[model samples]
Target: MSRLNHQWISQLPIKKITNVKPVSGGDINEAYQITTPDKKYFMKVQPNKTAKYFGHEINGLKALGKAIRAPKPLYNGQINGDAYLVLNWIDAGYQGSQSELGQLVAKMHSQTNDKFGFVDNHETGALNKTNNWDDNWSRFYVEQRLEPEIEACEKLGRWNKWRQQHMDNMISAFRKYYQNHEVVPSLCHGDLWSGNYMFDTEGHPLLIDPDAVYGDREYDLAMTTIFGGFNDEFYQAYQQTFPFDDGLQDRLQWYRFFYLCLHLILFGETYGGSVDSILGGF
Candidate 1:
């Protein structure tokens, strides 16, 4: 308790970390709820060594602020050179179920990107997604997005070798599919998942911990459905606001394959068979 208290209070640019407590999160970083004369603030000590994300995290928070959705990044500084992040804690209490979540996330994604990608660079799971962009979604997705992770997975021995041929074929198929597809770079939460979203008191989603990127809007939308967090209502609401092509349903998998491979890399065997299965199906 003393060590954590010192870490939170003493290291903070503020003083008197009264009512300091741990905040639950699935992040590898440590989070805390601290009460001060001002108000409650959420603080996280980021893993500075393995974390290239702090810089991007700063940008993502700013981006989310501009979009006017998601939590705002407050203050961050180093304590003994380890990075810490502060965020205005919004009660991300669940406001609705699947469908509502779908709608809000779609709105968030609707916020456009700067040119193609931003200057920030970071890794998505174990894979290093390119900050560089091109006008072509299929080319960008294949060469920059999927190709790196696939190669990394092979190097890490986390890859499902059986799926290489499948990926090759999918790549070819997507090349043709992309030919007919319109390319637009939308601001993506980079990693939008059910866990990443929370409903505020007004029932609107306030997204947090983005791996923000500028990519095909579908990439963000598709990731929502990858592990099954959103529902049809979300899709419906999103379409009403920002409609997709008539053929999106038939083409959803085209976007989903990236994260499946990503999960296969991040979680190891739990994701291995599924990766092969998806590749096989393709």
Candidate 2:
């Protein structure tokens, strides 16, 4: 681990820092467990980024915390060309209730917005997202989400005639189906994969590292299905709490295609087949 600059350390609100140990924070940032005599905190450092790099995350945590358990953001700033965010530490625990987690997520999805988007645009890896507000969900999704990703894939030489044909078909299908269906602009944890959630010391589920947006709730549910951490109990509770509209299962595949396609752009051909599988279905 690179030694944190003394100047940077001094700028932090905490004092008498005793130890700083590395921790798993995922692929994007350098994570550390900060220790003092009386307290511990989780910090994420993004090299060469401005303080604004963590602005979206702070907004997300505040939004999610209102409806579900989420880490409390303490502070964020830039020093020595690295941007960092500090959050209240959550001790890891085993055996959190999946049903409770499901209920919490369902409650969170109930928070709606007047339009689809967020206060600011966000980024995943090097790719930037345009989250401009729009009244029409289909037009917003197709223009802001799908088109940008496809453009990135094309620039990377990952596009082809076959993919293009399927993509056009999928877009048409998505627009046509949603034209009749009324979709509420519900808040979503844009990245809801298994690794983004954890059980605290009290066995309570806590959401972390959100890429939040106000969009179709099914878009969030689609992320749950792509990974296997959530079980039958979780889905059962979610359905009981907030019953889904008919044909939700079918629409989930379309949202799944968006995430898989993003993975393909971020990680290359390993995810190409998964993206194609969804597109082929369309």
Candidate 3:
């Protein structure tokens, strides 16, 4: 980790810092556990980036926090060419309630907007996500989400004619299916996975590191399945809180395809078979 500027650290309102130890934030940024006399804090730093680098994250945290337990964003600024974001830290715990997690997530998804998108665009690692508002979920998802990932994969030579043909078929099927269904613009944690959730010291589930958007709630639920953390209890609780419509199982595959295709673009062909598996069904 690069050395944090003492001059900048001293200027913060958080009083005298006793310690600043490096912690696992994510692949995209450098994380640290900041200690003061009375409280602890979490921070993420982006080297050579401006304070605006964390703008999307701050927006996401505030949006998610409205309906669920998320880290409270305390401060964000740039110092000596590095961007930093500080948030109130929640102490980790060993046990978590997946049932409660499900209910809370259901509530989070209940928060909705008239249009599909967010106030700002976001980035997952080096990739860009355009979140311009749209009235049509199908068009917003296809044009803003799927096509961008496909274009990136093509640029990296990870895409081919076979994949393109299958993708086209899948897109056609997706558009056709959504034509008859009514979709609400529900808030979603745009990059939810197993690692993004945790239990706090009091056994409260907290969501962290959100890449948020306002879109189909199913898109958020589909992400939970890609990684093996949430279980049957979670889904059951979610269904009890907010019932899913018919034909959801079939539609989930389309959202899964988008996530796997993104992994293929970010992590190469290791995810190709998984992507093809969904495409073959189309």
Would you list the rank order by TM-score, best first? 2, 3, 1
- Candidates 1 and 2, the one with greater TM-score: 2
Q: Write the per-residue lDDT of candidate 3 for residues 1-282, one digit (tens) a residue.
A: 446667757765678799888887657888889999999999888888999999999999999998889999999998788898999988899898999899989999999999999999987564689999999999999999999988898899988888899889989988997898879999898777988989998888988888899999999989999988999999999999999887788888989888898888878889999998988886
Comparing 2 with 3 on lDDT, the higher-scoring candidate is 2
Q: After superposition, how far is residue 39 of candidate 1 from its true place, in Å?
A: 1.0
Off by over 4 Å in 3: none
153-229, model 2: which lDDT tens digit per residue?
99998889999999999999999998898999998999998998899888888889999999999999999999789
Candidate 1 residue lDDT tens string, 41-138:
88777654432447788798788778656666777776655667777767656566555666666666788754567667775457776778567677
- TM-score of structure candidate 1: 0.89
Please give the CA lDDT of all the candidate structures: 0.73, 0.90, 0.89
The residue-level lDDT of candidate 1 at 36 comes to 81
Model 3, CA-based lDDT? 0.89
